[model samples]
Each structure stands twice: as C-alpha cells, then as structure tokens.
Target: MGISAAGRAEFDQCRLIDQVLNRLGNAMAINRLIIAEGKDSTAVAAASDSLAEQNESYRRTKRQRAKAGCDGWQRD
Candidate 1:
C-alpha cells in the first residue's frame, strides 16, 4: 500500500509543526530556567545541569537549525 499525495503532504506538514512546537517549548523552558536561576550560584549550577540535559534532548533540533549541518553542540 502507498500513501496518497495529500496524505503525504499532511504528514510532512504535521511533522514540521511538531518540530516548531518542540523548539518553542524548549526555548520557553530555557527562558524560565534562566529567569528562576538568575540570583544564586547553586541555582545557576543546577540550571546548568538542567540545560546540559536539555542540550542532549534537543541536540538534533539544534543540528537542524545549524547552518553547516554539524551538531554544533554546546554546554550553554
């Protein structure tokens, strides 16, 4: 069996929308972490750890947005 053209288009559009939403969610989470951790070193360190975990989670997302297609991974 094969997908119809319209079905394939819908799948692609859905995938793109999902990617955008995930990126937005990641950005919002990072922003909240920054705001909540703005005062203390301990909180900053904990946020650093949290960001590190998020970096791993969003590694592919970053690569997709990178200009050179490299992973372009970073700690911050």
Candidate 2:
C-alpha cells in the first residue's frame, strides 16, 4: 500500500529528526571524550566547541520545526 501525503510528510520529518539527533549524540560523545582526556590543544578544543554549537543549533532548529507543525518526532 502507498503512504498518504500526510504519512509521507510525517516519515520525512521523522527521518530528519533522527539524523539530527544521531549527529548530536555523536558530537556529545566526542566532546565528552575531549573533556575527559583533559586535552589542551587549541585545535582540539576549538573543534569540540564547534561541535557543541552545531549540536545545539540542530536541537533548536528541531524544536522550531516541531513548533511549526512538524510534530512527528520526539526528543530524547
């Protein structure tokens, strides 16, 4: 059976949410490792910070999207 238009939209939204969440999770893991190891290199620290920012941005964007009517995804 083919999916309805609404169902397809929901699936796409869910997929995008999943991808963003997975990226955030991976970034968090890497950030944790960097902090745990007590790394002091400028490049490493900068990269970690960038990852954190990106993760937060993704989260905020997801929230905005949800608030705008894409309610097919759930937060962890």
Candidate 3:
C-alpha cells in the first residue's frame, strides 16, 4: 500500500509543525531555568555581602573592647 500525494504532503506539514512546537517549548524551559539561576545567584551574593559586613562590624567591636582593656587580653 502507498500513501497518496496529498496525504504525504499533509503528513509532512504536520511533522514540521510538531518539530517547531517542540523546539519552542524547549527554548522556553531553558530560558526559565536561566532566569531562575540568575535570581538565586543574586540572592546568594547579597547574603554573602551582608555576612561580610556583619563580620567586619564584629571585629571592629572586638578591637575596641580589647583596646579599652575590657577584654582582659593584651594585643601583640
């Protein structure tokens, strides 16, 4: 059995449409993943900056306390 010319053309057109839709869906998914990763990295960077600032502040306070002789320890 053989497919008619018209039927084969219709099948080809359907196959092309399916391929385009699949590619579009994959592109959208990849774009979403990239955006999510960017947001996560930004959040992590902000948290890291905050932690570093807090650590610096703590160190400054410790130095002041030691300088005032309230730490009961000598700085060398």
Give the winner by TM-score: 2
Ranking by TM-score: 2, 1, 3
Can you list the residue pairs that collide in candidate 1?
none
Candidate that beats the other on lDDT, 1 or 2, i.e. the better one: 2
Tens digits of per-residue lDDT for model 1 on 3-67? 89976775676567557648757765875677576887776777777666666666655555453
lDDT of each: 0.63, 0.74, 0.56
The predicted structure with the larger TM-score, 1 or 3, is: 1
The list of candidate 1 runs beyond 4 A from truth reads 40-76
Please provide, for model 2 over 1-76, each residue's C-alpha lDDT reduced to its tens digit, 9 standing for 90 to 100. 9989987887787778767767877777777777677667775687678777877787787786676556645464
What is the alpha-carbon lDDT for the whole of candidate 2?
A: 0.74
Error of 3 at 68 (Å): 84
Candidate 1, residue 69: how far the Cα is off, in Å: 31
lDDT per residue (tens digit) for residues 1-76 in model 3: 9989976775666555555545545554554555557667776566556555545555665555444454344455
Query: How do the candidates rank by lDDT, highest first?
Result: 2, 1, 3
